[model samples]
Target: MRKILHVDMDAFYASVEQRDDPSLRGRPVVVAWRGARSVVCAASYEARVFGVRSAMPAVRAERLCPDAVFVPPDFTRYKAVSRQVRAIFLRHTDLVEPLSLDEAYLDVTEPKIPSPSATATAQAIRAQIREETALTASAGVAPNKFIAKIASDWNKPDGMFVVRPSQVEAFLTPLPVAKIPGVGKVMEKKLAELGVATVGDLRAFSAEELQLRFGTFGRRLHLRARGIDERPVQPDQPVQSISAEDTFERDLQLYEFEGDIRRLAEKTWLATRRTQRVGRTVVLKLKTAQFRILTRSFTPEVPPASLEELTSIALSLRDRIDLPPSTRYRLVGVGVSGFRERGEADGQGSLFDDGERSPDSTGRPESL
Candidate 1:
């Protein structure tokens, strides 16, 4: 069994504020910039007690937790701490896959450390992070990403959970369908209507039957219900598609989405460049207030030569929305795919020249 560990920092931004400032300790803390449009970047366990949450409007968070101390987000500081955490992870294994600034997945099937087992390796990593960073992290050790991610969250604020290979089914069976990754509220309600409230209940339906009802996602649901995920912990994986998205506090019509789209595109652009890769396509993703998801993409004869072209293509894609003009959207995302190694791709080439594409490929995706 491959040993995978998921490490997630507890209340990363708020915890950082608390660690740096003693007075902020024990008091509910929120990370945000002050403004009508500002959103809470993070909330401490203390603040969460009062229903404060990340991505809530700062004004709303303040009203919910009046006693909460607010600190502006310091991404520089967080990035530095993240580097330290990554260094700790590397000491054990090079197969680390970072999910974000505050979380990563490490494959330690053959650990470099003197630790005797996967569980021991996780314990050691968590201990070193706490000792060095003065911050708590939660970790989960399991056979795959699906189980490991869920196990990591089983305990919060500096804890560790483990699921041995033999216990995979037992660990997954009793969980609510909502606990399955990708089964958001909407999917949960649909599953509930089918009496598939738990992973066990979901498993009762044949994979073909579920697929007929849910399309491609039906297969994913079938596999995840059995605690099976074959994704690996790939270190320094090549960047293919870079994207950014946001969920608005209030849904907005298409015209009102222009500013948000541009902002998200800029973020995606910056991220894409950070990978030192070039991309040839722009993709726009949208989710309606009712939870319907749609995506539009364009691959220019020439890759977008500049940010101006990127933004223009993204905005034009919005024009293709055949839905009613009144359709309001709660979320939008912008991405660049069909990435090429720097100076490697020419206008005549395609991203799939490698013979076949892996499901995990982030390169130009096929249009639905």
Candidate 2:
């Protein structure tokens, strides 16, 4: 059996803020800028107890924990720390797949360092991280990626869990179906309607029945329900897309979305600078007041080279929306895709070359 480990830093951003500032050590800390549009990047455990969490609006976090200390995100420092943790992972195995700045999957089936078991290797890595970075991390060891990922979160900050190959089924059987990867609230509710509330319950449905109901995802659910995930851990996976979206406090008409579109575009533009790739497609996403989602995209011959060009293109996409002028929207998103290595794409297409616009049939955001 292959040995996989999912290592995740505990409240990474907030922990760093606390580690560097002694005065903030014991207090509720939130990492985010002060603004109506700002979202919480991370929340310390102290803040989490008060219902504060990452991705919630800063205003909501402030209201949830009135005494919380707010600190602006310092990505430069976070990236530096991430690099340090990555270097430590390399000491055990080269098969590291980073999911984000704070979490990664490592295949240690044939580790560089000698260990009696995957659990031992995980403990060693966690110990080394603590000694070197003065930061805590949680880890999960299992036969595959999905289960390892779930086990990693079973124990909170600075903990570890292991599931041997023989124990996979028993470990997964009683858990809620929502614990499966990709099983979000919508999927959970759908499964609930079918009398499938747990992994054990999901096992009762034949793969063919599920495939008839969920398409390709039905097959995946079949395997996951049986504690099977055949996917391997791949190192250094390339970035396919980057985007930012927001749900407004109130619904807005089509013309009223221009400002939000521009702001989201700028946010997406700044995020793209973190990578060395160039984006060839600009995408505009909208969610109607009734929760219907629509997307419009454009692929210019030449990739946008400046923030102004990106913003202008995103704003221009509003023209393609065929919805009624009175149609109100509750959310707006801006994105860039078709990433190419720097200098690999020679912008040869004409400017303002628009692509197809389509509404999501799944009533969900398309996976980037």
Candidate 3:
């Protein structure tokens, strides 16, 4: 059995805020955007007591915890701290897959640490994080990734939980079916109506019965019910797509959103330029005032010929939408997908594909 551990920082953004500001420590701290339409990014445990949570609307968060100290998200500092945490993980094992800036999954089946035990490795990593970064992380160590991810949440801030190979089944049973990933509130209600509210209940049904009802996903549900995830920990996974989006401070009509779309497309284009690959598809995304999301994509015979062409294509996609002309939108996004490495393309030009003058790709004499 492979030994896996999931490390999750306790309210990462809020904790970083509290750590940087001594006065904020031990107080109800909420890290979120300070705008009417903004949503909470993270909430400290003290703030959570008032029902404040990440992704809750900022207005709602304020109503829940009137006395809460709000701090806007600073991704730059968070990334610096995240690097430090990742460095700590590397000491125990090189097989680390970062889920986000604040959480990661480590496969320490062959630990680099002197201690030969996964539990001991987890403790060491957690202690190092607390001591080095002044932030606590909860860790779950188990025989597989799925179990380890769930086990990590069993404890709160600055805690650890372990599920040994012998205890996997017993630990999984009796837990609500909702605990399984991908089983949202709607799916939970459906399962409840069928008299299956727990993982144990799911286990009582055959895989064939589930597949017949839920199609391909039903087989997945059956496997998840048995705690039978066989996925391996992957490091340095390739970026499949790149996109940037913004939620407006105030809703605007469809015709009033061209500027934001172009700006967002420019941002997305700049981001894509950093990659060695180019995407063949341009996707235009819009979120309506009622929170309905719609997307339109145009995949030309080749990648966008130029940045001007890209921006124009995205704006033109807006005209293809069948929504009411007076319909308002709260969010807009621009993205590119269907990536292909530049090295694999035949006569495909570099970053600026407009047949324009290219940057220096000449011979380099000095070190990189």
Candidate 4:
């Protein structure tokens, strides 16, 4: 069995704040910028006691816990800490797949330290993280990602749990179906209607029955409910797309198009920087006042090599809109797609090739 470990930081941002500032300890803390448009990015365990949560409006969080201390997000500091945690992980194995700044999956079936078992490797990694970063990390050890992810959350705020291969089924059977990844509110309700409230309940339905209800997702759910996930721990997974979108507090008229384009282009650039691959197409997505969607794209002679080029091309496409100048919009987005490794050979010519291009190019990026 492949030994997989999922490590998750506890209330990452809030915990970091509390660790650095002793006064914030034991107090309800919410990490967010102070503004009407700001939302909570993380809440301390104390704030959670008051029903505060991430993504809730800062105003609402304030209403929930009037004494809750609000702290602005410091991505730079968090990223520095993440690097430290990663360094600790690398000491054990290079088979680390980071899911986010504060969470990752590590395959330590053959660890560098020659641990006696996967659980020992997980404990060592968690202990190293705590020692190096003064931060607590919860770890779950299992045979696969699905089980490992569920196990990691079983114990929280500096805890560890392990699910042996033989115990996977019994361990998952009693959990709510919602515990399965990707089973959101709608999917949970649908499963409940079909008497599939728990993993064991899900197994009562045949694979064909699940397929009929959820299309392709049904097949995967069937396997997962039975404590089976064949997906591997892919190291250096490639990114599929890069895009940035923003929702404005109030609708904006096209008269302010230039400002909106600039803002969205900046956001897109920020997202692109996070991925190592380059994109061949640029897309502009606009949401009108009535929520009608309009999209324009451009595949330039030379794919943008920098954020400035991306913004310039995106702005040019925005100017091509046929709508009346009075068009009002509530959201604007910029995206880049058709991503490929920098030096990887693409069947199609280089994005900058001057030869005949595909008609679908429309000098635009592909859609979701």
Candidate 5:
């Protein structure tokens, strides 16, 4: 059996800010740009007590914790810290899959440095991180990735949990169905209607029955209920797509979408720079006030050479919408896909196409 460890930093961005400035310690801290459209990137444990969370509107975060300290993100500093954490993981095992700057999955089944157990490996890694970076991390050691991820979150802020192969089922049974990776509010409600509220309850349904309802995801649910996840810790996974989106506090007319589209386009473009791959397609996603999603995509004759070119192509896609001028939208997104290594030759393709549709239970466009 493969041994997996999920290590997650405690309130990563906010913790970094606090560690650098002692005065900010023990106070509610929110990491975000202060603006109407800005979203919270991270929140300290103190801020979380007031319901502040990442991806929440910065304005709402402020409203939730009026005394919360707001700090703008510093990617350069965060990346440096991430490198240090990754180096520490390499000391124990080379099989490391980073989920973000704050968390990663490590396969320490045959660790570089011998340890008594996988749990011991995790404990040592956490200790090394604390000593090297002065940051606290929580770890979950399990037979596979999914359970490890869930276990890592069991105790917040600096804790560890271990699940032996023999203990996997017992460890997952009492947990809510929401603990399943893709079981969001909508899916959880659907499962509840079927008298399936917990992982234990989910076991009563056959795999075929779940597949009939949720397609491929249903099969995944069946396995997850039994604490089975066969996915390996793949190091250096390539970027398939990058996108940025926002839901407006109030619905917006299509004509009024320019500012938001431009903003999201810029954000998406900046994010793409982190990867060495070049994208050939630019996608524009829109959601109606009633939650109907539509997407438009374009594959340029040449990959967008600069941000201005990308933003122009994204903005021009607006003219292709056939909706009435009276239509209002609740969300807008800008994305790039069809990634290829740098210097790849461009392939001939249609300039425009109606993007494929696959709406998840939450009635939102499914991520690629």
Candidate 6:
């Protein structure tokens, strides 16, 4: 059995805000724009008491808690703090897989400091995060990712829980089926109609039965319901794609195409800098006011070598949308994918280099 640990920063964005601002401490705070269309990005525990939650419309959040303070998200600062947290994880083990800016899974079967057990290692990491960043993290230690993930969320805000191999089944039974990953509101409703509201109920279904009903995902659901997840912890997972999207403060006319494209391209470039990988394809995504989605993609002879090139391609793709100039867009996004290292091509070279030769033959330097 592998020793897996899930570390989740508690209300990460809200905690960061509270850590930086003394006055915001212990108050109901919602991180979001105070607008009708804007949704909450994060909410402090104090705000959660008033039914405020991430993704709740700001207007509804205000109705729930009239005095709730609203603050815009600062992803840059959050990302910096995330780096510090990741460094803390690295001090213990290299088998760390980041799920997002604030949560990650660590396979610490062989920790750097052998004195502490896996459970203790999780505690130490969480403690170090609190001491160094002045933020709290909840940790879950278990034999596998499925249980470890659930354990992390069992107790929130500076808490730690462990699921021993022997106790996995008992621990999973009776838990709501909705707790299982990928079982969203729709799935939950469907399960409810079938009286499968809990993990125990799901366990009663055979893999064949689940597969017949839900397709391939049903088999996954059956396995997960039985507290089994065989997926291994993958470190330094390859970046399949890099994209940046923005929910505008206000929907803007598509006629404002140039400005939106430029802004989105800059955002994408900034996001890609973190990976330092060259991409062969560029994708542009747009969401119209009517909630319709449009996408355009391009693969060039030479992938964008600079942000300027990326911006030019993204802007050019924007013109291909069939929407009228008067149409309004609620969101805009730019992305680059099909990453490749120099000298790495398909068949003769790296897989990503298939049919495309690098401008320079010398291999690209490995990123840190």
Best by lDDT: 5
Off by over 4 Å in 2: 243-253, 256-281, 286-333, 338-368
Best of the candidates, TM-score: 3
Error of 6 at 104 (Å): 1.2
Q: Which parts of model 4 have CA positions greater than 4 angstroms off?
A: 247-258, 266-332, 342-368
Write candidate 6's Cα lDDT for 31-56 as tens digits.
99778667788899999999887766
The residue pairs that clash in candidate 2, if any, are 301-349
TM-score of 3: 0.86
Model 4 CA lDDT for position 154: 89
Range of the 10 consecutive residues with the lowest summed lDDT in candidate 5: 359-368
A best-first ranking of the candidates according to their TM-score comes to 3, 1, 5, 2, 4, 6
Candidate 4 residue-wise lDDT, 55-146, digit = tens = 67688899999999999999788888888888888899988888878888888988988899999888888888788778899999999998
Q: So what's the TM-score on candidate 2?
A: 0.80
| lDDT sort, best first | 5, 2, 1, 3, 6, 4
How accurate locally is residue 59 in candidate 2, as Cα lDDT from 0 to 100?
A: 87
What residue runs in model 1 are displaced by over 4 Å at the alpha carbon? Answer: 243-276, 285-296, 300-302, 321-334, 342-368
TM-scores of all predicted structures? 0.82, 0.80, 0.86, 0.79, 0.81, 0.77
Estimate every model's Cα lDDT from 0 to 1.
Answer: 0.84, 0.87, 0.84, 0.81, 0.88, 0.82
lDDT for 353 (candidate 1): 17
lDDT per residue for candidate 1 within 251-342, as digits (tens), equals 89998979999999889887776777789878888877665677788777788877788999899988877889999988788988989877
Candidate 5 segments exceeding 4 Å error: 244-252, 257-281, 285-332, 340-368
Please provide, for model 2 over 306-342, each residue's C-alpha lDDT reduced to its tens digit, 9 standing for 90 to 100.
8899999888888898978999987889999889998
